[model samples]
Target: MYTSTPFNIADQLPKGLQALMYRAQGAMDNEASGLQRRSFLKVVSASGFALGAFPLLTQAQAQAATPAAAASALKPTQQPSAFVHIAKDGTVTVTINRLDFGQGVQTGLPMILAEELDADWRLVKSQHGNADPAYADPVMGMHLTGGSSAIKNSYTQYRELGARTRAMLVAAAAAQWGVDASSLRTREGVVIGPGGKRLGYGELAEAAMLQPVPEKVTLKDPKQFRIIGKPTGRLDARAKSSGGQSYGIDTRLPGMLTAVVAHPPVFAGKVKSLDDAAARAVPGVKAVLRVPLDRGGEGVAVVAEGYWAAKQGRDALKVDWDTSTVEKVDSAQQLASYRALAQTSGALKYNADVSPLATAPKKISAEFVFPYLAHAPMEPLNCTVQLSGQGADTKAELWLGTQMPGLDTLAASQVLGVAPQNLKMNVQMAGGGFGRRGIPSSDYVVEACAVAKAARTAGLTAAVRTLWSREDDIKGGYYRPMHVHRAEIGLDAQGKILAWDHVIVGQSIIAGSPFEPFMVKDGVDATMVEGMKEPYDIPMRLSVHHPKLNVPVLWWRSVGSTHTAYVMETLIDEVARSAGQDPVAYRLQRFGDKHPRHRAALQLAVSKSGYGKRTLAAGRAWGVAVHESFNTVVAYVVEASVKGTTPVLHAVTAGVHCNLAINPTSIEAQIQGAALMGLSMCLPGAAITLKEGVVEQSNFGDYQVPRITDMPTVAVFIAPSADAPTGLGEPGLPPLAPAFANAIAKLTGQAPRELPFKLA
Candidate 1:
């Protein structure tokens, strides 16, 4: 049970003890670390604490002599037990363990606690929780937040926490009044007893905390939830609307210098020689230092008084790089080779193939290829670091908008030669992560720390923050692997799918990467598992994952589903047409009532999109597709009209259903945004090539995203569910490409097998 005494660093304690506490709390703004300068305010707002509770819990947990005692003491601190502390004066403080980027987790998360805690929701405060293994998500198993797992993972725990706290508060009031606990119930912000006697939660916080923590917490049924189902105003809405919201880029320190690393054009290349004299001569260029790459990465750094100065100085510095190997690797030819590789047979089998690739009455085969894509988060990649002086004891602090805070802490500690405990990592609001934030084996943070250490002079290492320009970030390493999929399906006499064989050839996103230790299994990456398996019951279905060895691949927005869904959904349409059946009706026959959510999505989209109805507008047709990811199921129906030279999608109807909605408004925004993002990838976001490698496109200008003019009018609907919450962010994305492509096929009278879904 959480005790509600306001935390006070006792003044009578030793000065050193106070300093350590203050440092750990991250409240010492006078001599802030690199992390403080780059992300202090941002982290404070995004996570809602000076620092997270992990360190405080770590300090307390370490005092236990036995593991059992430590476990007992922790007790997982059920949501009601930890969320929303009430003070004597009535200040309601809410604790949020979920990480927030621009996704509004900071706002949505606290709303759940406020709803059940029954505190003055208007005055509730918020804070971020620290990383702890015990607090690790039951599904993902780490004190981290991504994959749209925030609400889904915390939904039940937090609601239970709120209800339990309400129970505790009611019990406390009942005890004071000498009445039965069951006779008292909560309404609004006060506890009301049988005789109408009442007391605010603030008046009973200390006593409530002393109550025994309940082992079994009962959450309120959905029927009684007040704040969850309805759309309430956002918690951070006022702050954001008033422009008081601080993003990572707005973080700054007193003596902080802006730093920018000059990354090698080619992967794994190094600087043979560099002249920084001209850079040193440039105004505002405080210090010009070259830091060696950590591990087997590529780069050097340039520090200056400001961002523009650092970028200018970096551009002026002469660098001769070793790009001998990758310079000759042509992206166009390499992609073609990967396509060829898809046809070959060496691949790790995931699902056994009973398919008729070994001779059948009718066999249809098609090859589909996908292009590389950038995460292109609204906020580009950036980090701030401050390294202390020499020796293994040298401490480094980092402030990065990364998804995996624990991983950042470990990597930064290793690079700085300090124990992980001594290192501080502050996670700021990522402009966006989309799986790009938790990339393994990438030294983006380590390089910044190394540069800070190398810049040390006179017992003072450099306080540097690195910023990757939009251009640099888009062209940067770590991208979604372009893949080639070879699909062969055999149909019986009635055109029912009997044998299905799918071979996927792509760079392993985890193989040989830092995540290899965790994500890889027997050389088969499960990232290829999503759309690779036949959701429908196919008697003979075989899925093979052929890992394209060279090049680095990271999980994109939809990860494997981005590629696999395109193949499966489009092929399903082909088979439906071959059988002379309606696409929606045919798919429905394959699915049963067992998957209520999946069926709901199909039915909702079919009805809303007028699936079998005629299009009044000439030259326009509608097409539909459905896919499931991160436990959430989505179906998309697109209405497209051929514009003579290009296919222009005019409207779309989408249906999604996750278990519970912490914030209906935010979930809607995420679904709507994800749909547009997926649409752009299918049409304008294409990677072209030159004589050597990728060329022309860099940022939004060359590689266009969806514009206001091109955006389709979308109608989104949510299906209700009674199970555990599923992810909402990415599931809405995987179906857009196929939905749009299928529409194009109907209009053009040709099934388009590749992207950039153009008729020409």
Candidate 2:
């Protein structure tokens, strides 16, 4: 195994208004293309950002654009009672409605608020909010941090929150001076009255609380924006970079016991027998208890004074795991099964005619495979649970970094036998989640609560923290599903798509979850076929098979685009080559005028990259790819070369169009980290393979992650827009692998059919 320090980009780095339809409010960000087939919303392919802009901001921005309106009704959840807090020291703290697992919403959302509040940037700070109804997304009506909707969905809400606070502060200042509120103006935390009278927001904060909260207030226009578009540094950047930051794993409670679970080797396997004689002999060992696991299984947890003692105690225990009931998944055999299924007609997703395929001038039949991937966030999954009292009077507190705090709270409360209202969730700073910590089952959280409950039942009164080692996190269940995409592509004489017949085989991510009714329709998982067609208009028959597998899978970053973008882009490049045309030009021609955002993004990357103007070294070639995910578009123009069997990415230039650039520096960091992660897909040993129902790889020793040296020189440039920002987190990742594959294809004269590049 190679040796290296953990390359954690999380420590290092970094929407418009339109429809009010329920589908728009609760819709997935990447469904701009899926609108046509979706029964709820009519598809408007010609208009990209207009149709999918954050829907709640339409009337809010219009009415709130003015300084003050006749007081309108404010939903209890919309009031700023819990969000904006001012200290006597003039420190303005903004509470973010979502978790900050390195996406910089901890800073970005505050920028939106502080901008509208006209607060001094130097004095503004941010903190993560709890699972209160006040923090829930107004549109989705949930405590969610995914789909890049934090700023997009909350822009108007935060603006109004800031404006209302400003209004109340002005009203307080005006009443003190016996002047109308309109006569006073706010500038950098100060209310300026007639004759240069001024007061800091700190002095008026308490008095401002007594004033009526305004429902509508003015928002600065794009031209008047001083902080919104400015490339300000992240509030947490210094703490993160300086190693002074605290994550959930760093929590230390009084008399808290540390826990390490000895999970069954096979998923859903049960512990046949567990002997804790040696485990109990360990000096710091407190207790050894068998607890119920997620998926109706059982595991033994070792509770000790600390993590090291707990782990040692766990290692000393003897456990017998029963694998008889669970399915033994073999990667080789599974691939064979998937390939076999791809040959037949599966459930129909799109029923476009295939008659043109038989009569087309040329045809290309290709099959691509993608393997399961672990999230592997820098901090392994963990949760600290403190239980007090019992039964109906039970009160519990949990500390963790969670994407879906509300769901996790519900799950933990149920496991701990505490009422949901009695459970207090402290949203902690997370190293990174990338979608692992947001499981619908709330697996880790539930397991922690279960361990605490078992400990309490066993007479241990202290709180318990369930900690997963790096090995456990890597081998843990929720992984990106393995996928096989088989396609028959037909091209006319002009190289336009005559027909595309496609079949995908993979496990459904949302099948058994509470979201199954909404996310899975007509037996087709919506996440499986997201990135296919449009952005380019192509007629095709799309089919899918969601084989139920024993392994649990969740939405990894960018979800379906992790595989779909690779298939579509590589195949598109191949078709472009066959047609003797430039890949970028071909994609541009396909984009036409229907998608101006895509066109602008591609053009920006092309011009900034000097694609045709600069001459590359003989060994290196320019590679290009563009994709839209989470409603954000990212285009890459890369310079790449091959060294032996490995692909070497030399330089990358990204053209990002998420409408508005809230923080260009943060956007750059996200792209760099995501691209490096994408490069990991092409490295040897990247796949999370399984054999005999046991994970073949455990930790970084066996798995391959990109090292710092492997990172290319990435340059990011944004295409500016006045429209609201869209998702920026996952879009950067999807196009990176396909662009690298396209580059390697140019060097080898043959495209890679699988990830981790099996080149000869």
Candidate 3:
């Protein structure tokens, strides 16, 4: 009952592009070693010619009796959560269950399964799975990937799938040898019998398909893991390192043109009218496509043959924009609006009444504000799409680096008027994502599809459209909202915290977007309270969220905690000052009584940093901040001195996350990376405000990130955590601003709350 079906998809590809997939090899002489059943070979030798190959799936065709492809015509544009393939040669491949924006999980996650399956690590590969409902996030509605849930969400399911595959192979081997299944056991790339009979994983792969899926298969005990705990280099590192990797900018299809877009000078503005005659006359210009804002939000864009040409054409064209809505949208206005709103009783409320303040009459009330922020990832947004007409291959192919591929696919499909399956999205390595790339709406994808559709009429097939010059991305509309917190804390004379009331006012980031269902509720946005409420064992506390007067906001690197943690930790420092207590001691006392993990991190940071010790420079002081985010706890001690009134940081000592999929080394690298990113935001990185609207700081030059010169000597200590691997990428970022602010406050008798601290 064994059958092998072979069909060629090469004909569907361009002339020189053969199928990218191939079969792995099995042991030739050793029939019983079971080694053939476990190993997915990287290279196979046949007819004296050695071929190096990797797992490449070219969409398998269903067998005669299996579910017909048409019957299973899943709306590919919808979104998929999980889509994996197991080749008959023991090769295993998984679509990216989540997005990768340089967090290294695109390589780390597949390693999790290979570790469990005991598959040859080198041979395992992955692909970008299109969005579908089946791939929907268990927690979120659709197959969306954000909120540090990539590994956490897929932990058990990926292992189960791998284990199930292994069990089938074992069963197939048992049937082949006419032996009881109990006699066989799987090891690294092999299955062994009681009498020493063994078979390779590849040899049993085809036969394994005939076996029924095991009702249940035992997962490996953590102690028995071979590859899961071992540190493996990134699977895509070589390709990226050698400059062989193809990013969205490298996407090329037959006759595909290039495109650039001209958006409004301000956010939420409408294009009144534009003349594209001059743009259309450009040498490479094909069509001056007018992209309208009516479909989704605001602004109009122009399409051209090449990005530079599009830019040239855009500059040459004349247009008038209705900036009525944008005129009232300034940072100061937003801040004041949020401040007033924070005083109101919002639809969603927590820690509402300040009755707790009565218990301790000497309460502290402070207002903290964090300005709007931009996710200036290195690679700007780019998408390449190729769309054919209805009944004329109605499919569109997309190549881009997006944290929200599922959403991108769905949006692209909607614009193209095709099913999701008709759209193929190649998820590329993001130069950086940092919450910005997880845009729920596929605005960029839609724009690319629109450009491609227009180009198709002129015989253009492969068109790539890129958005964002450093100016464009920095001034981009989706922003980390300017947030204001009106926080009041009541403390007894002895500094024993009694009550806490925190009210955060900011734009409703999720109110009307695709993420609204999970993010917005009762006028409360969860992101607004992420780090606003302490996990401390406070006697009485209330956290509240107040929506702004209809302004736009989005998630930053640390999401809500990007600002909330700063407010919470800085306010705690103020409380310590009022009580005449050491800042570290106060946090330790409070956290020790409430959260052991938080206390553990805080103590480790203090102890390792030599807290209370004098630095080489006189008038220099140190301040500490501890925050928990993305399930990882982190603490920082920033040592600084006041140059005039501005604080110049000299060194940073941090005791942060230890739970990791890889090891302490990788964890430290991520922590360091996040620390630098955090510093930039707190220093010269926040978006500036002007009379017109948000002004462009423009790239890393004007909107400076922490460079080697700006960076301090950082010491990272990993508090050993046996807990499940928590996120180390973002948690380190939340504490940097607060620690720096607290340090400056100690050096000078001023509690600096406003970000980008300037003493003048």
Candidate 4:
């Protein structure tokens, strides 16, 4: 069902002002309708004012009886808008509002819309939506693609859009046939009517544009769905597999020069002096100019004919950095400080008296350390910017795979001294983002725009494409914040949680971000404390310390769940073992009846993996963990064996409860990918470190990711549900490490408390 954001008038506003505000809001809703009406009128008027012979359904009946409108109570704040485009050749192009960074939203969203549209699957295609106000997320009111919200937020919206478009087409066809619109039906790309009459949607496109948009339209029921819930192949699989897909890194404009910047070794360090003579002497080098970097630092960008030339010029450049302004962050020192801070309560998140901890039957005090982690998307960061015009008429265009295109456009506009509307962003497909592409500062995009503006000022008059080498991309800041967690737990003989006191010390990701005002409250960053004590409902007291450090930090894939899930799940497993009970049963007991999804998912994994019914090999053991992130629950039952001093995962069975899987194949792929990433976090040398304010690792050689050999056999199972879909991208990640670690703990009799486990 269509759901629109309700307009509420403040008591302070005058009646006249409130009325004006309502009118403005209504205009926004009707914007798409107006466009559709104009197109339809033009077609009908041009066709000698020919009218359809069928009677249209009354607006009231259409609004009340439609399954699509009644299914969802929360509708789009604005009208169903700019996504579907039908070509005369019957090719239907659907524009996705979010970045397609391997999470399968590129195909999943279209499946939702196309299912309701009843369009021919073979004729359907998809494209990335540009940074336009019309494409803003209906709920977020901005361009964003993180937190695995792409499908969850836009599921109903896209479905309504398809239903509306189909209704309009039916109206057009009914008019032409002089039949009742209610008697019309659509199957595949054809409209069917009495006497088996049929017409392709392409033929009715022009006339359909003239029909008034139905405020409500019927949506297909789950039993009737032909697209969603099916194992459909990705729309872009062929292009990507065939090496024909162009990511942000592949963007190239005529006369576009490649740029590589030599940044300060220290975070926010400035260049005291520069020597560019040798750099300029390099052939193909166009210009070398100092530019402002993210975090108020300074860098020199070298523009050249190509990437190789830019790198050569950048490598040839020399600069003396002034590091006096910024604090030199040493990883070891920071860990020491964090450990000390974790001993004391800083800002209270959950305040429950834990005085009973001393008297509990069983007690455990644990300290866990999570090091900084780089996002390290497969494709390195890059942006292409072109500037035109001058002064007030100046226009700027950008090409990049941006997670927050609107934010990037705003940031680029500020950097180039242009209006946001004048700056155009052409969204491109991304190889993979995890969370790197959604930086709050739009660092890489702004840097590219700065280089373009500087090049234009220097009479270069070419589009500048700023690219980051592998080393630069890895060493560049904005890694996940390092954290130290200390927990003191008291448990009863039955393995039930009695009292728990926890303290976390880490850098705040949202402190200086535009989202801080809303995301951070009462001196607590919500992202920092999510997944602390949940599902089991045994929270005692939790406190956090947000230490402002020179090392830049941002949200990783699952944000706080990355660490919290490990802590919670592992600790719960430990408690179960200590109580002489099965871990899965213990979890189920604690879950009681409130967490049916969690119980169902864990039960599915257990039943499928034969956790209690099957015997393990001589050297192997079972591990199980369940977590909910992004409103989705994922449970993993893993088999692992310890070889020498290292732990090796052999197989994994996953039970996912994301509700109504849009594409079962995509969900399976995402789970497998996330599981591997989780395993990557446990491998040695996976940490991102800082020594005296300089990033230690530079590339894959030092900062390791999982290779194909490291992957285990993963089997995914989805719980049965017809409820609204939840996010699948990140939920699969949080449970993997904890489950793997639990198995290792069983083998070694010691629980791992740090990432990149050190069995030695």
**TM match of model 4 to true structure:** 0.91
RMSD of each: 8.2, 10.1, 9.8, 6.3
What TM-score does each of the candidates earn?
0.87, 0.91, 0.84, 0.91
Local distance difference test, each candidate = 0.67, 0.82, 0.64, 0.83
638-752: candidate 2 lDDT, tens digit per residue: 9999988878889998888888777777788788888888888888889899999999899988899988888889888889898988767778898888898899889999789
Please say which candidate is ahead in lDDT: 3 or 4: 4
Residue 594 C-alpha lDDT in model 1: 57
**What ranges in model 3 sit over 4 Å off?**
1-94, 132-135, 138-141, 194-198, 294-302, 325-327, 343-348, 356-361, 391-393, 457-466, 539-551, 592-594, 612-619, 657-663, 688-690
Regions more than 4 Å wrong, model 4: 1-81
In the range 1-760, model 4's lDDT, one tens digit per residue, is 1000000001132344324323433433343323343444454345321222011111121232335533434333323335666766667777788999999999999998899889999999988876655465665666678787888888988898889879878988999999999999999989999999998888887667556667767778789998888888999999989999999999878988999999999989999999999999999999998999999999999999999999999999989999999999999999999999999998888998898898999999999999999999989999999888978989888899999886787688789998665666888999888889988799998888888888888889888999999899999989989999999999989887889999999999889876666667799988888888888778579999999989888888888889999999999999999999999989999889999999989999998898989999999999999999888999999999999998899999998898888899899999989999999899999999888889999999999998888899999989989999988888889899999999998999977999988898
Q: Which lDDT tens digits does candidate 3 get at residues 497-607?
A: 777766676776666664455455566776777775566566534445555433346677778888878887888888789889998888877765658878878888887
Tens-digit lDDT track of model 1 for 1-760: 0000000111133344324333433432222222332233333333322223334332232222134323433334453433555666656666666557666677776777667776676677665544333344534444456666777767766666677677767878888999988788887778988767888877776556445445465666777777766665666677778988665666686678887888766555677788888887888887776666533546767778889998889888888877666544466787777777777654465555554656666677888877777777888877788776457667767777766665566667666677665677666666776777776553577777776766665233457787778887776757787777787788865668777766777777767654455445565566765665546777534444554533456788778888788888888888887777778887888886556777888788777777777554888888888988878888998888778777787888887777666666777777788888888777745653333543445788877677898888888777765566677767878888888888877777666777666467
CA lDDT for candidate 4 = 0.83
- The TM-score between candidate 2 and the true structure equals 0.91
Query: Candidates 1 and 4: which is better by lDDT?
Result: 4
